[model samples]
Target: MAAAIAARLFPGRIYVASAGVRRGSADPFAVAVMEEKGLDIRAHRPHTFEDLEDMNFDLVITLAPEAHHRALELTRYYAVDVEYWPTADPSATAGSREQILASYRNVRDGLEKRIKERLGWTPPVSA
Candidate 1:
């Protein structure tokens, strides 16, 4: 979701990639929440840090404690900047359908907000 939001917000200005500590499948709730914001993550496949094709990145923003630690380890081999955002994994949230979606949406919105703030992104003016 962070990659999707950052890509949409910055487009050609910067490159964005997202990965976790381990490979996993996409979350249906995540796709739904992203769709709510007009961002499609239905095809987004969760990958691990090892799956990255290129390691030449300027910055890597990790959303989980494990991922943050894994990313810190990467600094030993790659010259990259790592920032931890301490995001909660909404997949672990237990509730009804709407409640589950709400959890995912919270994560989506929070990630988008942090990305915009960290990257200095502002919506364009309507003329």
Candidate 2:
């Protein structure tokens, strides 16, 4: 969702990608939720943070608390700004299909809001 919003709002200004601490397939619920807002996450694949080592970024935004700590530790080897976003883990939510999907949607919405505000970009509307 962050990547999609960034792509839509900032175009080429920032390069956005997402990775998990451990590699896992993209969550179906995540795809459904983002689709609700017209963001297609269907092609996203989970990546390891190590895969990002070769890339250069001006900023690293960690949406999960654990990732924040790890990103901080990783940043020592490179010079870049890292910010913790403290977003909830939608996968941890337990409920029926509808409820679980709602959680994911909330996460997508939260990320979109945070990214727009932090990056000084305009909010994205459903497309």
Candidate 3:
């Protein structure tokens, strides 16, 4: 979701990728929430950090503690900035479908806000 939001917000200005410590398919709820904001994440395939072909990122943002630890270990030899952004795992929420979706939406919205703020991005004026 972060990568999708960053890609939409910055377009070709930056390269953004999302990887996890554990590999799994993109959650349907996550895809739906992103699509609500006009971002398509339906094609996103979850990959582990080991699957990254390039480790040349200028900045690595970790949304979870395990990822932060992995990022630190992986980037120790390189001069990359690693930031840990603690986020709630909406999948842990227990509720009805709509209520559960609300949790995912919260995560999506928080990520969007943080991405824009941290990247110093303002939405381009739509003409």
Candidate 4:
């Protein structure tokens, strides 16, 4: 979701990739919520940090503690800025479809806000 949001908001400004310590399929709820904001992440494939061929990122933002630890360990040999952004795991929420969707939406919105704020970006003007 962060990657999708960053791509949407920033366009060609930066290279953004989202990976984790573990690999899994992209969550359906995540795709749905992001689609609500006009970002299609339905085709996104979750990748592990090892899948990344480029370890020369100027900044690495980890949304979870385990990821932060993994990123630190992986980037220890290189000079890269690692930031831990403790984001909630919306998948942990168990409830009805609407309730679950709400949780995903919350995460999606929060990520969008954080990406913009952290990157010091303003929405592109639509003409």
User: What shift in Å separates residue 102 of candidate 2 from its native position after superposition?
Assistant: 1.2
**Each model's backbone clash number:** 0, 0, 0, 0
Of the candidates numbered 2 and 4, which has the greater lDDT value? 4
Error of 1 at 126 (Å): 3.9
Off by over 4 Å in 2: 123-127
Poorly placed runs, candidate 4 (over 4 Å): 125-127
Residue pairs in clash, model 4:
none
Per-model C-alpha lDDT, please? 0.87, 0.80, 0.91, 0.89
- How much does candidate 1 score in TM-score? 0.93
Best by lDDT: 3
Clash number for candidate 4:
0
lDDT of 3 at 113: 93
The 10-residue segment of model 2 with minimum total lDDT is 48-57
Model 1 misplacement above 4 A? none
Better structure of 3 and 4 per TM-score:
3
* Candidate achieving the largest TM-score: 3
Q: Which of the two, 2 or 4, has more TM-score?
A: 4
Which candidate model has the greater TM-score, 1 or 2?
1
What's the residue-level lDDT of 10 in candidate 1? 93
Residue pairs in clash, model 3: none
The residue-by-residue lDDT of candidate 3 on 1-127, one tens digit each, is: 9898888889899998889899888789999888898888888889989999989999999999999999999999999999999999999999899998999999998998999999999767899
RMSD of each: 1.2, 3.0, 1.1, 1.2
TM-score-best of 1 and 4: 4
Candidate structures ordered by lDDT, highest first: 3, 4, 1, 2
